[model samples]
Target: MLNSTQVSYFTLGAYFDTKQVKYVLFLILLCLYVLIVGSNVLLIMVICVKRSLHEPMYMFLCSLFVNELYGSTGLFPFLLVQILSDVHIISAPLCFLQIFCLYTYAGVEFCNLAVMSYDRYLAICHPLQYHALMSLKKVALFIAAAWITAFLIVTTTTSLSFSLPLCGNFINKVYCDNYSIVKLACSDTTVNNIYGLISTALVVFVSVGLILYTYMRILKVCFSGSKQTRQKAVSTCTPHLASLVNFSFGICFEVLQSRFNMSSTPGAVKVLLSLYYVTCQPLFNPVMYGVKLSTIRSMWKRLFWVKLK
Candidate 1:
């Protein structure tokens, strides 16, 4: 049994031999990383620079886009490198750091979505008081709270996983995972497991509960209110609903993959399932919002036209 200190590097057991296809995979992932970075940064810039988009919804979106960038950057670069490298090993500190980055990214993503749902509830259900309710200060505070809460949660998780003395350093996934690390512990993991369950429940239930509650209120308004009210709810809430559903599916798959034995599953499928949440959500949100939101669409078109001119 190797002590945590003796386990200087963790071998990722998931990467099979890519051989000649490695270059193709590398290029594909590189392009994906570039697109994720470019699209998200553009959206963030548009929101930040345009005074018309200074409202609470767009402010929350800016935070969401920023998180997409953060999360994608955490995985894509390492993935690109690993795809090309023969040795699929990550240093202990880097592994833990990746675990921290990706975990917090997931946490922040859920919390940000929850906050956006609340913002929508205010906009649709309380139009008259929406501005008063979701002022710039409150928006800032909400965004801060979302990010800070995720940071604190993932920080504790990563710290606990990092301190464990590992019997083995082989992770059966493409990237560093906190649960996988806990499973490698030579010492008792009662604390880690207990904390993991508590934190997971806290984040999932609270975020999902808030989203459900807000949407219920929004639906109530749409049903009883005028046609304009219904249209408003449909227009604003559709993209959010789509994003939430897509993200939830991805996270569910990831959680299942991490916790359960899926050894019988094909390697490629397993890899795709593991990468889906991190890759797809970031790619999905920008495109979804850009296409779905009229104001953002118009602004994006105008910006493109100006650039062309």
Candidate 2:
């Protein structure tokens, strides 16, 4: 068995041709990371400080905002450094750690959206019993479950991956990933592949199923109710739907890239799609929630207006 130090490093192949525009890419990514952090932090602060916004929906939103920050931190820092460095190599241990963080982010994101959908479903479909159904304890439990479940799931996947002996260390992507690492394994990867598939299927199917069912029930109620009720539903659910769609599209691009032969695809396109969820989703979530959610927008405007005044 090779010792940890003897394990070879992986070259981040996604940066192979960006030398000419490395600074440009670095600046763009840095700005994006800053915006993600700043916008999510602003929303989180507003949600935390505003006693009036202490409902289950806002609480769930707070959990998502914090998660965006967590997810972005996993990728952006290393990416920024790689953009400037001549060698775009990462150690095996760090690669595994990154895989854990990025995958956990994706997992937790799915859980958060699913829980948020349920919160909306209860509020809209069962308004009379919303309070009892979505109590503080319940909301807290759901949020904790999202984090804890994601952590444990990714922890197991990462552990299984670490046991495999790698034949090579060339990762043809911008960042470390579970699939990429597993692809380099010299040993039998049937177990890792099987577990990864099962875990991913469970997270995806369960989350998507919950979202679709809740939204369907929500839509049914909206159509049968008064015009005011319909408008309220649209206004409140729009942000969640938008965020979900954005995240879904990113996931779709990634899955397509992984499942299909993308040899003819442009390197830039591959990089963008690969990094889409990590980079864009983090920024998109807060922007959608901050602008589309009326309560958040009004509070944000007032806070800025007061600061300027």
Candidate 3:
């Protein structure tokens, strides 16, 4: 019978008794956090410091790396703390804040990818006009728009969920989620549901449409162009395509877990699937881009070698 205001904390029911293995879990997660932070920060620094990388593509990449860092930070530290503590409770305010951070991170991730695809499209399909189309100023604007729009959309989402009158304070997941909270509302969630549907549709459709359209155009150009052009397209677009597919799969798993009843599923598998998108994408993108993209790969290697000397 408690409303949201009366609900001081939320219990995260997803965590199980790891017994003494929590220490092992903690160490493993800590290493993962370090790796994610280190790899992403390294790429960001490389993109920013290298004068040769000061192009639209790298700039978009830098933004992507930054978002990976932002998104990972939203989850890892809190997750680390919860892993050790017996109590998996998060304060209502902190729960809302995490929702804001994570949701915004997701929104920005998709938008950023869409923007990068367009940048690639312009680079390969319209080489002469690439610079003009994706100038530094425009790149800056695109990055800003991606971030700002995500913030605004997630802001509305979080606010709507926060204002709901909750009948309970138990979230069945390891972290805060807007849908889970909305489902806990004692009052009507018609507005929240409507807005959620609309925002999700817009974000998904727009970002996916842009990515598909740009890739289609890029593919058309590649097929008709010279061998060198085809090679260039393959080289540049492989990592991006891989990244998009990987993230999409992770998101699909999460959405399915969230929206559907998966109680019959194994608990461990469910937990992993729930965390796959946020956890894997941060680690995945850095590795994929670092290894696949020669510019970043060579730059990081040269810098490491210089330091070794």
Worst 10 residues of 1 by lDDT: 157-166
What tens-digit string does per-residue lDDT give for candidate 3 at 1-309? 788889999999999999999999999999999999999998898888899999998899889889999999999999999999999999999999999999998899899999999999999999998888889999999999999999999999998988899999889999998899999999999999999999998777899999999999999998899999999999899999998898889889999999999989987788899899889999998899899888888998899899999
TM-score each candidate. 0.98, 0.96, 0.98
lDDT scores of the candidates, listed in order? 0.93, 0.89, 0.92
Local error of candidate 3 at residue 237 (angstroms): 0.6
TM-score (C-alpha, index-matched) for candidate 3: 0.98
**Which candidate order results from sorting by lDDT in descending order?**
1, 3, 2
Candidate 2 lDDT (Cα, whole model)? 0.89
Please write out the lDDT profile of model 1 over residues 10-44, one tens digit for every residue: 99999999799999999999998999999999999
What is the C-alpha lDDT profile of model 2 across 1-309, one tens digit per residue?
443345767788877656679899889989999999999998899999999999999999999989999999999999999989998899888898898999999999999999999999998899999999999999999999999999999999999988888777778888988887788787788999899889998888899999999999999999899898888888889989988998999999988887688999998899889889888889998888887788988998889899999
Model 2 segments beyond 4 Å from truth?
1-5
On lDDT, the candidate that comes out on top is 1
Candidate 1: C-alpha lDDT: 0.93
